[model samples]
Target chain A: MQGFALYPFDPPGDIAALRAELRAWLAVNQPQGDIVARANCWASFDADFSRALGAAGYVGMTLPTRYGGGDRHPLERYVVIEELLAAGAPVGAHWIADRQTGPLILRYGSEEQRQRYLPGIAKGELFACIGLSEPGAGSDLAAVRTTARETAEGWRINGQKIWTTGAHFSHIMLALVRTEDGSERNAGLSQLLIDLDTPGITIRPIIDMAGHHDFNEVFFDDVLVPHGALVGTRGQGWQQVTAELGLERSGPERYLSSHALLAALIDAAGADPDPAVAALIGELTAELWTLRQLSMSTAAKLAAGEDPMVEASVVKELGNAFEQDMPRRVQAIVTSGWDDADDLARLLRALLIASPSFSLRGGTREVIRGIIARGLGLR
Target chain B: MSAAREMLCDTARAVFAEAATVGMAPIDNAGFGLLLVPEEQGGFGGDWGDVNAVLQISGVLVPGLPVAALIANASLQPAAAVSLMAGAMGHSLALSIEHVNTRQQFGRPLGKFQAVQQSLAVMACEVRAVEAAAAVLAARLDAVGLDPLAADFEIAAAKLRANRAVGVVTSVAHQVHGAIGFTREYDLSRVTIPLMRWRGEHGNDAYWAQILGRQVAGFGGRGLWEALTAR
Candidate 1:
């Protein structure tokens, strides 16, 4: 309640029931279809799966039921998300909205905004994209130059957003725009939920190294929105976005991204893997558990409604490295699969192709390191 | 779990798990006390029993370093670590190094051989016995009044066990690595160097051994086994 603390990772009273229900649900509903997810990459979207999750009341789980949420704890939501992700459920479309935006609105949205947006978001009919990165402002959050000019109609937005994940498919862009053109740097920023179908907005796909159109570059051209769309006080964009990043950055997902592969690899290698493999796996497992505790602890702190920025940053920086390394080591071992009869070649091929983006996607390693240095008072 | 015991373990585990969440990673993963607060500042709250649980869990993770970190802490906590904290400015690490050098192997690091492992096994057994005795005494301390000096003695057993175990174990680990372990960033010494340094601090193996020897001398031959089973 005071300092940023964490929730307990131990199972709660209802956990056994929750686990059983969720386990059975997964068995029945493994996302397997022509358009369903293979690895549940948060950028990959499938409409039916999104709609089905909402129908099952699994969307916006931690928010209040009045807003169409299930009124669950964040940790409970974490368990659900963990299970869904591990099962490779087709949740890419709903992930951003459910994981970040719905909570953001609940925390800072006005009544009109909440009534208009949250229920649909919780129902998974509406999806959101964070429009923070730009051609010039990637990872330098404070450098956002997108201008939102005030007019009688509302705010006229004009800026270009880059690497907007799911932008091509999202219903709304929760864009951080520069308001007032104030010289306070971080002080002039504001978050605006601009409808993607707005007259002046344009979206174009950016194909990645993996040949996926999961990211995009979006342009805002005099896009008009009502004044009520501004989140919290207009001038506190920096503060609000900082809080948003904290939510995005930490938690179980940070380390669990490559866990499926880790589990598979460990099983293939068996216990007492070669000294090198065992050492690396052992190292990774220790860090994974440590990060799990740290993230869960931070979630507990946030559950008590406290800002655990430092602890969250510690988790993120460490998690970033751990996540990035898992795929690399997996690749190394899988590469050896060609020669070693004991190697699982098929699994190795999948890991070799997918693990490349491990460091770049979540948050860049460099960005996280900067946060860590600042967090440690080394800045 | 007793209410006091459960609360103590949970709170301490949560905080420690958090503090320990940070490190330089693989090289830094070999950490124990670095993450734990000092015992007197209401830190490392788990008693001898906690130490045993920690060791058991340690066996699961980095079987080698997990034990190494705990042993390192034990070495530091009692003989050298406590003394250093108490303002014992400078001291030599005899017991720590002697175990490393004198041990024999395949013309290698006794610090590097299987024979050292045998020695290390003996040391581990000693640490285990001392930890068991201390755990019982810790429960006794909880039930009775405070005896800071007796507590210090418990701390001593931990250190003696730690010093001997770390010295012997690390030497063999280093031996297995050969020359590569000598590199600065190799992660080999992530387990070895710290043990070496801490063992050298105030008292290494022999330093703590003398203390145990004196206690044994005080009770004639009965001191060794009696002090161990005193719980």
Candidate 2:
């Protein structure tokens, strides 16, 4: 339990160089669209854009060179993703695979799995989605009824996973399933890497309120996976999934979701704005700035191989609140009722619809608060 | 934590704990006022990280010290800023926790209620956020030795966060403690009153927020992100 330090956010010379290189590449190759449309940030999926990003060697940055990755520090990867999200780049296609799955595979995947999947992921040709949440088990992941029983033909899986983002397009799914029956809820659970196109698998899009097709419901009926599909040890799924959630919760993406809108709001507010507006914007900016520092500090701990699970949960919960509050604040400040065609108005409207999901995704507010309470020894 | 830093914090904690029980002044004996000054200048040659750790400990102990404010505006001669922000915030939280755990309203302790737990969780989050901001600013100061242009923005942000957190923490704490907390006789009032006063010290939330807002505006939309991630 190492105490906290103000983690340096100043990019090192090499990371600064990487940031410059990525910015230059984005300047030349980024797709043309209204900035508001791109405000969706990581949720904006573009396979071609992801391919371009991978071809440019920006994807799978933290992996080893043997796997066709940059083999850089996690801080380097952090710099890259921060830049991508700030610029409102469409990174959704390869986001999950690069951010969590690739690293996880490197840690726990077999040599065969590493050779087969990591290189593709580094190349951005392969994409993945999480399959931890089921229809009845969202925040309470231990209640997942997805069963993957072993057989002569490897393992047979039968269950459904809801709110599986990018399931329609992902090439792989890391499914948390029950492999054994036990009195303990977390016991006997295991994570299996299931290829999305396998037989007896079905995926249906669950369009969000913002009319985004980023989420899907995936079903499996006797879907057979190879015996080698299991990740880490069986019955260790609880630990592995918890670790994965740490990655999910503590990233630039956690707070940068509405960054584009904020930038636009600042632009819309103009210079020498109303006192109330200036203060509101300032408060939000201060909170956002502080949240980034907190997130970066957690990242530093992760880079140092510390769990910092409690800190990660705190960042996610607070960041979720800030992100959710952003649109309403903007709506209050910019009350002129601009035309729907205006970029700022459109982005604010988009965020208003999307804001509710900020707290709901990754973990609900209640669940995160419970985690925080437990961390503080209050429970 | 390094050996020296750990020693400094432990000494501060021990002194503050003693000061909390006795009516003695913690700063008079703790030597925290001299912690930031270099040894070559006839004071303890400690860095910002050490001072920050001590301040957080002071917060927990509610030692009613102005060590942070003294360090914040340290001159050739140490001047009192009379700010007890950290100590007050920490003390209020501690009092609330103690109150909820020992004081029962229904069939169980107050802390056993879900509402009280949620409020305390939020208060803890605010405190942790301020701690993080302070640590970040301290690290930046340690690295660059207080370049005004860079350090001012970070300092403003940290102050703003701290001021804001004190508001939430003090309010929730008093709410948890109920009417007893409002009385001067109660220990909670000792911290809560000081916190309200400290919220205006150095700079209040609104004052620092305006400064931060101006800086963010000066950076423009695209450049604002660069300015924030610059360090």
Candidate 3:
């Protein structure tokens, strides 16, 4: 409907059918009010709304049913994520849980861990966060200085994690720490499932530029954990963490962050879009389609059980560039002040405020270029 | 265009895997370059996609194979390269260099001095131009069937850029490599050797300028750029 776009291939889902189903679901299950609006959607610390997602079985649709999932295709999960993001749904709370940690657990968790955790995760009864980044060690994950020493009971984790989104309100954090006594730096890293509510663990919110507590600094001070807390085999955490990063970095979420903003901006432009505005839309739309196909190709590859880290990096890097570029272009097209707050306008305000972190969040642009260079044979 | 491109890329990927050989040889050897022409065109069906893929895959063997005459022809497709494609070895790619070889005001290897940085930048510009143009054109080729002559212009531009500048980049590479380069055993020539050969084999900027000029004239002043860039 936007333009004569060459989507090129049949969209994976029957787009209309699924969109109609979701619209009906939303109409029946709208959130309580403006406070539970898109700004903080699922992440408004809204217990009731999260429970609603659980009841609707909207969480973790791709994992096995034994773990409270629909066991559907990854593309189905993609459809859900894209729809939520596009509608400006408050997915911030369970976003990390559903996106990265839940899948990592499913693939690498101990049987007991899977049975104890994933079902609640799929039900939205539980939330998860990641602790891969540290104050001194940001993009260089292997440089994580978190140290975990074995105690009489389990391992005691003693380190701090920065950029731990949703940690102040999260239930658990799957953290990577140096585990082995004297091994290769990468070899010593291992993932531990730490309870956020446990004593000696502190989570203090870091107000980002938008003044939201969406991100936090979490400190682990001799935190007690049982041996069952380890997510996977010891000494293999680097490889496991690498695999998890691939999952985290890839996905439609990488590209759809600005879809809501684009929609609002385009709608605001009205029926008589001038040639300049239309051209911007055309170019942006074409690039976005390329990203969608590349993302879908990665999903297909994953569904076929291949690790698509390199391809996923390429998609995320290119997609994030497009995402970051959208707001600047939108600002130029609209005459209104950017800080205006009329529902969709508020979403654009939030997106403009949040756009900088998009490139820095999963990985920096420099790191991504390094990856592409390696894949392109330049490195 | 998309269908044509997909088929060509898929087939080229398959052919390279089928025909390529031991480390460092496929690039420098004539046996492989001969495949650039279509097997029917007295040459192999080696297209730009194959060259791009080869450039990408070339890194799977770090520092990559030497670019030699045939590898150059494989990508640029000059008549001499076409001749080589027809099983003639054609003219060797050896360059007649006239590097000052002496230190100047800086008392350093003239090649090592900052004065030559422009030359290095120019060479780099050439490589950069080719890579960017190739990617941009590839994205477009998926949409329409342009005349091969249209692609011929693009390839000529890229080859000119590559040939003109590669000498600078590769020559400095040898200067940096030092006596080891002169030893002839070091693979330093792995990069420079192909730069020299490809430059001469493609008929260089002089030959391409004339051809491109003639082609543009025949287009009645509507050159490839004008056609391609038209909204």
lDDT of each: 0.58, 0.80, 0.59
Q: Give candidate 2's TM-score.
A: 0.92
**Predicted complexes: DockQ each:** 0.03, 0.55, 0.03
lDDT of 2 by residue, A1-379 (tens): 1233555554345776787889999999889886765675788889999999999999998889998898888888888898999899999999999999999999988888898899999998899999989888988888889899999989999999999999999999998999996525788899999999999999999988777899999999999999999999988999998888889998988888898888987787677766776777788887888899888888888888888888898888888888888889889867746457787888888888888888888888888887776665565
- How does model 1 score on DockQ? 0.03
Q: What tens-digit string does per-residue lDDT give for candidate 3 at A129-148?
A: 88889987887777788889
Q: What share of the true interface contacts does each candidate keep?
A: 0.00, 0.51, 0.00
lDDT of 1 by residue, A250-355 (tens): 7666665655555555555553445455544444443443455557667767776777765665566556556666767666654455444332454444445655
DockQ (model 3, Cα): 0.03
TM-score of each: 0.63, 0.92, 0.63
DockQ (model 2, Cα): 0.55
**C-alpha lDDT of candidate 2 relative to the true structure:** 0.80
Candidate 2 clash pair list:
A9-B231, A10-B231
lDDT of 1 by residue, B31-67 (tens): 3443334567745444433443343333222323333
Q: Ten residues in a row with the worst lDDT in model 1 chain B?
A: B84-93
Model 2 misplaced stretches (Cα beyond 4 Å): A1-13, A181-184, B13-33, B57-84, B102-106, B147-150
